[model samples]
Target: MGEPAPLAVAYDEGAVSPAEIAVGVAGLAPVAFVLPHSPHVRKLRPVLSRLGRVVQLTGRPERDAVLLRRLAPAGVLTFSESLLRVTAGLARTLGLPHHTPEVAEVLTDKYRQRERLAAAGVDTVRCRPVPDVAAWEAALSAVGLPAVVKPVHGQGSRGTFAVHDRADADRVRSRLFDGPEDTWVVEELLRGRPSGPFGDYVSVETATGPDGTEVLAVTGKHPLTPPFRETGQFWPAALPHEDREAVSDLAVRAVTALGVTTGVCHTEVKLTPGGPRIIEVNGRLGGHLNELSRRACGVDLVRVAALLALGAPPPPAPAPPGRVYFQFNGLAPVRPGRLRALTGGDEIRRLEGITGHRPYVRPGDDLPGGVGSVFMDLLTGDAPDHPAMVELLDRALPLLRYEFTDGATTWVESPRRAC
Candidate 1:
């Protein structure tokens, strides 16, 4: 038999790791990596080279396409939100299956995506763009109070905030817009249920193609820490059968409206009192979901993504999870500082239900504060039920201790006790 064509990955920092990609496409196709020039990429070259042929992007799409074509790749895909459009362009240039350039643009640009969803009647959240400080007031007035303001192009809730009143809006403007010229959007906040065992938001993980969109799983989220930083996520969100069906229906419609005819999509939806509302549709796989899905239900979404990229038929929906698998992120402090110590790591790892543990920041690493701050630690495991999962996190999280210093002062802090 002839050798399989390679799958080109538009690689970047914060995307899936080289090891994960290698495992995902094993025995299915050879792998090629396309990376933009950056110091991070420089460090990644050796690691990536061990996995596949690596090509550095020349900053021009057409030129990069020519270089990628040399690999004779059968398809192209990306796990990074920032690389979706470029990857789409490459797929088009190579006549490979992927999101069209237009679909990719909508997926990356939050304001444009909101507009497209509203116009298509999939959603009608009032949205306004804030190009600069001059436009903040007007945009706020249009969107009304209790609105959400976030960068037009951002992920990880880096600059996302809830503006409940004029004061909150002013703070968001000062904190996010004072630095440089950037675009942002303000939209009406979808009102979630007042109280529930779960967070008000859930994400539908799906794979779409010519056959149709398949709902692989619905992920449950932990409550946001201030502004809007994700604390963690669990797979097979505990939802009533009807609510689950409704969420799945809305997610399928959202992807269809956004012109997603191929590839996997992570659609974030708010479970509000009124109904399910889309937070946004991401063109790539949601961060860390692949591992969570696999651990929970034996579904390897990363492999599914690779297969879809190669124009293979979509796999059947994953069977219902036997246990509730969770990944809880230990959030950093809300004040910027250099980490000095993180205690109890050994204890947390040895906990009964603990399956895996990884520290994201170590002593001497500078950690950002606010909603933009990343997780300091990630703990993964499964539980017998939803309540049991919550109980596991409650017990395990308090074990970790953190100390930080900001030149003049040092302080010890406990991880945020939520979810």
Candidate 2:
């Protein structure tokens, strides 16, 4: 009889597309996708089916565990934050290797993450979880003004605020909390140079296997927009020898402390005046960095993640000093409006150093918070140098136009003007 088909499983939260991860996993073995019923997944079913089996996720631990066992997967993979716990639970149930559910909890919840890091002697900001308005006031007072208040389980900078005083605190509190059901954290803000090559923070992308953990690349982030939204990121962040060592060392400690034994870890660190401090650790490849690594340095993180899941060694990633630089610009609208239309696609796509162009908003789509579709992820590009890359991005902004409408009126937006 022919050997049984190699089997692997993936949790699709329909958050970011898992195409890269799924494709890589399929290269080694057939993959099965699990999702909690979404039209998005259903529409992509045909394309995903070509990669592997697609299954409905029932949201019941025991029932899902039975389905996973029936599939007899050799490993499970997930990149969605909400699905981390379920993925780990399934792995545990199947007697397969995975990060424990407890560790997944620590990675997903900010408060728990800080507590665990502190216990491991890692320097993290002073933080407290406040569940009510009264507690929010107290936590802000205790942590001091200019503190950051963010959802304990938040992502993408949503509901994260920098409260500088009582007025700011009260304003954010009224808008942020609905009831005691809300869990938030207030912490002292770390100060860093406003302008720098690495901006104020950096993320270390590491891959771990049987031998040990490898710090594959350090990515430099652009300065965040107000309220802490990441606007852009560049790969192979140039760091001084000492800074690089310190950041990489802290990344290792943070991941080891959390008991992440396999797969990829994305660790963010603030370059504070006191040195690097752990911000948070993610149990998946850094968003965009995965593709950036492949485009810029020839390191395919998705492939590495898949190989690790299947208990195989990934190919060695070539060290930097390569020919191309990789980057992406997340175009977040500064005001909310209905997207009427987009113009200049052909011109923008033809720009030098421009690899691709994608618009996240559709004509007539409602744009909220002045930010257009926050879910809109743009493109990945390869340029010859930093300046040329920036120029390329700048040139595209002028070529394209966003025609939008509010309830009262309509206007044409040249993103170039905003930038």
TM-score for all predictions? 0.97, 0.91
lDDT of each: 0.85, 0.72
lDDT of 1 by residue, 116-207 (tens): 99889988899999887898889988889899988898888877789898788777778866655389898998888854556788999889
> How many residue pairs clash in all the candidates, one count each?
0, 4
Candidate with top TM-score is 1
RMSD of each: 1.5, 2.6
State the TM-score for model 2: 0.91
Candidate whose lDDT is highest: 1
- Cα-based lDDT at residue 7, candidate 1: 86
For 144-174, candidate 2 gives per-residue lDDT tens digits of 8788888888566767788888888778788
